[model samples]
Target: MTINPLEYSAASHPGLMRDNNEDCFLSQPEHGLWLVADGMGGHEAGEVASAIVRDTIERETHENPAISLLDTIQHAHATILKSAAQGIGAPGMGSTVVALKSNSESYQVAWVGDSRAYLWTPSREGGRLERLSTDHSYVQMLVETGVIRAEDAEFHPEKNIITQCLGMQELPQVRVDFVEHQWHKDQWILLCSDGLTDEVNDKTIAQILFESNNCLAAVDQLLHAALTGGGRDNITLQIIESPLRDNPLRKGLWQWVPYLTGKTLVDAWIFGAALASLVSILFYVMYF
Candidate 1:
């Protein structure tokens, strides 16, 4: 019998002040993995970094029945550099990355930059959401060593300056984590960019998920929460599964491979925006 390995669902939102959104998400139910990346460097450069990460790492799932968490992340790093040299987009752009992969019983994670992964579970003494990745940012370092309080991290001048990211350097920073849980319903998992975590702390995030939280609501509420709390940067969020993973079909081959492709009318709007963004980015990157 083909055992259903993992079952999951997820969502993402682009929050305020980005002319072009550079966030990306990938969920492979069959592989029991979900990824969220928040791109920096702006315009087409940011978009390229994020897209390459999502597409490249996800493609590996098609070949292997089970993906090694370490190998997947390292391959993603190489894929991004290869994409840059292939003449698809600008150079020197980079992005923060967080990825989660689960088996039938346990899970593993990898991270870099300020993006994060959180796990919530119930216990005999109740339950809690715990952050599993370390932020590779200047402010995070300060917070770690007791320089700035967590409350003050938002306004730090270096809050947005990530010390390391996927494409910014030849060697990227990565951390691997293994998380254990009962994989039950109402056990929430969160992956968000600095924009979301910058505006909302762990307590606030847990409260929202505890309240009226589903895929669409979580994305909207997180974006609004960030905006209300100052929204200084681009916010991207992906809340996946209640506890595990599930697969969904992808469609794109039938339509114009070179011309036009998408399901809904709103997708056409996104395409138009992408084209406009591509043109503006060409001038901005080339001239300036």
Candidate 2:
């Protein structure tokens, strides 16, 4: 059966309080892949760690078109470890990652640490906003065990303390989760760094998505909301809108660019390849 083409947009900002942004994201509609990684450490190490995680996963996915999503994340984890050992960044540098991949019939969402994936679908009563991925953070554990109320989690002092991440001194006891669901009309998927959630509330996020004209506008409004709500940390968001597809292979034409990096449409392989190289060089020179 034919399905509708997927539409997506991504944006990232350094936020008001931070001097550098330690977040990286990917939106490859052609390959049905999207990701958000948030790095944690001092100085430029955090950014380097996140970049390594994002680049590694992108390379692995592009090379083996059929690689398992779970395996791909593990590969990224291994690469991050190697980079840290080489002193590319701080010894404790690490990152949290959330990824989404889909086929014609269904989609897969995976993640480690506190980055999140949310699913929104239209309904007869009103649209629904559901958090598809659970956070691997200390406060999340407290909330799960009834030690704290969900409402209080946001203000908890340990809210930013994630239990698992990409790289650490010991081989990370990565607890990756996978969520699989079939596609439907008017369904949208959101991947974001903790910066967005830490600032904008759930209700505000749903309101913005429902009111926005397109996926791109939704991304813009989401970033605006985070900045307006304090913007204490780096903020990033990627929104994927799947209208019911009526064509074979779900092909469409549009430009996909990483907001922080230079623009290169995903359909243009030559330009995209060169841009990828430039990004690596820029990362090494800027941070190292």
Candidate 3:
């Protein structure tokens, strides 16, 4: 089967415990690219670095679709390094990036740092979630070496400590991984920051996506799961739903979920509080 044009949705939130949203995302359905980035450094610096990365990817990829995705990411990496060198960005500023790019029949996923991409598809037993990116982080190393179980890595104190990312001068060699998968109907792609995984487990995420009516509701449910489970960091995600080659789902530009209705009053209250928190944090990031 040929690859279908994708229908997509997205959501972002600062979560309850963070004072700023240091995450940024990009959606370019027309060009078949989407991204999620999580930044590190001080609050101000992290936000700036993430935005720079996001904007660079959007600009570079759109200008030349034939340019290699890895080359485009390297351009973003070089941009961040240049900004840091010139003092335009903060010292130690860096970001974790995960992106999905597609052609007419297959998709390529690439990542650096701990942000992730997952694929879900229906099966006779049940729908399944398959993580597409391996993290460049210390805890992940432990899991790889059998020093700890995969499940135990989540509870490890150093789970958030990544081994490599963009914008660090000492680490001249950063590793980026690329994977390719054939597209099919009833398949979904999820790109997200660690914030969502930190709060919601993989099983729960799979269940939510399987149960939801559409990609929009799945994104909402995922965000809700993260916020309600102690949103300790900025949360961001993009969902891409693949349709049949002959029939595609057409959607307008994605909007934040604040206007969604019909949930329990308590669910609405929780979402409202989470959104209010995000707005306040954004202002703090902007002005302070």
- The global Cα lDDT (0 to 1) of model 2 is 0.85
Which stretches of model 1 miss by more than 4 angstroms?
1-9, 122-127, 149-151, 170-185, 213-216, 242-288
User: Looking at candidate 2, what is the lDDT of residue 15?
Assistant: 98
Off by over 4 Å in 3: 1-4, 245-288
| Superposition error at 40 for model 1 (Å) | 1.6
Sort order, TM-score high to low: 3, 2, 1
lDDT of 2 by residue, 1-288 (tens): 346667889999999999999999987877889999999886689999899888988888999979988888887888888887888888889999999998666899999999999998854244799999999999999999999999999899989998889986676556689899998876889999999999998899999887775788899999999999999999999998764643432222322323232323433565567789999999999999
**Per-residue lDDT over 129-210 for candidate 3, one digit per residue giving the tens place of the 0 to 100 score:** 9999999999999999999999898899999999888776676656778999888766899999999999999999999987
Off by over 4 Å in 2: 243-288
Measured with C-alpha atoms, the lDDT of residue 106 in candidate 3 is 81
Instruction: State candidate 2's TM-score.
Output: 0.82
lDDT-wise, the better of 1 and 2 is 2
Compute the lDDT of residue 160 as modeled in candidate 1. 74
lDDT of 3 at 212: 81
* Candidate 2: residue pairs that collide: 3-245, 4-244, 4-245
